[model samples]
Target: MTVDPELLIHRDADDLAFSVAARMITAITDAQSTGGVAEVVLTGGRVAARIYRAVAESPARVEVDWQRVEFWWGDERFLPPGNPERNETQARDALLAHVDVDPARVHPMPADTGQSAEAAADAYATELAATISALNDEKRRAVPAFDVLMLGVGPDGHVASLFPGYPQLAVTDVSAVAVHDSPKPPPTRVSLTLPALDRSREVWFVVSGDDKADAVATALAEGDVPAARPKGRNRTLWLLDEAAASKLT
Candidate 1:
């Protein structure tokens, strides 16, 4: 089903990043107050890098207990653990390194070390299941309903690592899957399937740049783009810069 996303446009990338960072802090704080802990799924991109930097510098960073906020990635590049291009490495340098988050709660998808992408994906799924089970005493949750699941909308209208027309997007039972022949460089990745993304209470698509305008517009319109398909259980938000929102009607 195509759920209409709530649109939020900022004047520029800088503005968009800072606003998203602030909103994330607020969401984490709110969740911590009620749930004792909060879970958030992170994404990586140029805009996401900026958002992480903003979060690292924000004054409100101290308002929430970083240790109580669990961090997970939406997708991960199948490369060595320390590879700069890897989302986990970038996220650590951008924000995690600076924050006092619990290392135990920061779950990153397994990186390729000559291991098959499918193996890495299965490992991640098991990790997710274990974490959710440990945290929730009331119910046996295979996938936890994240307080916020942030995604970077690719130029090709992909979310996480699920590209348009990709078979991974059609996967329903699995919470995560392996992308073996992604059109994007690196080709291999482990990503949360649409089923996992939709498990979130809120999903935020943070997109910027004129290059992404068409994808943003197509996602908002009645289309079959993978970016258009995923929706949050409670809220699906599009956080775009003016350039990215230019083509939206």
Candidate 2:
């Protein structure tokens, strides 16, 4: 069932980040209350970093068991594992390091370790498959029913590394795909395909800033943009600040 997107506008960037941080904590806590590990997909961006920092510093951070939360990335820079530009590196520095998450559940996309982008994507797909397989249950799926899948919308309306009109947008057979000649910097990258992103139970688009207002409006209007594609199984939220939501009708 396709879920309608919900719009949540905040006063400012800080307010947006804090609101998302609180919602994230509550979501994780609710998921864990059912005796299942909470699966969350993280995105990278200035706003996302703020949200992570807020999560790390929140007084209610202890409401959920950090060790029971599984961390995954929506996309990553194809740089070395510890490179400052890598989403994994930023996430660890911002939030993961401060939490008590189990090392075994931290699934970062493959980095540029002398491997081709295609190879890295394949490896990630395999890892996703193996992880899902390990559940060994009747309700088997290609990927986990993520409790929360957070994404950041670029000014160009791209989600993750999926740029508009990119060939990767048509790839539905794979869980992840290699992206080359990206319009943004660090052209070579790997990202979860729309199919994988849509597997989540809840998809949150945490965006801020006036620069993103146009794209956010376009996406909300169901324009021909990649950001308009992925829909959550249970809920889809467009969490934005006043600036980002300004252009919306």
Candidate with the greatest lDDT versus the true structure: 2
Summarize candidate 2's per-residue lDDT along 1-249 as a digit string, tens digits: 668999999999999999999999999999889677888999999989999999999999999899888888899889987999999999999999999999999999998889899999999999887776675363454456777999999999999999999999999899999999989899899999999999889999999999999999999999999999999999999999999999998
How does model 1 fare in lDDT?
Answer: 0.89
Q: How many angstroms is residue 12 displaced in model 2 relative to the true structure, after the best TM-score fit? A: 0.7
Candidate 1 residue lDDT tens string, 1-249: 335579999999999999999999999999888657798999998989999999999989999899998899999999987999999998999999999999999999998789899999999989988777787754444556888999998888898999988888889888899998889889989999988888788999999999999999998895778898778877889999999999987
What TM-score number comes out for model 1? 0.95
Give the clashing pairs for model 2.
Answer: none
Worst 10 residues of 2 by lDDT: 135-144
For every model shown, the clashing-pair count is 0, 0
**C-alpha lDDT values of all predictions:** 0.89, 0.91
Q: Which TM-score value belongs to model 2?
A: 0.96
Candidate 2: misplaced stretches above 4 Å? 136-143
The regions of model 1 sitting more than 4 angstroms off are 1-4, 138-143
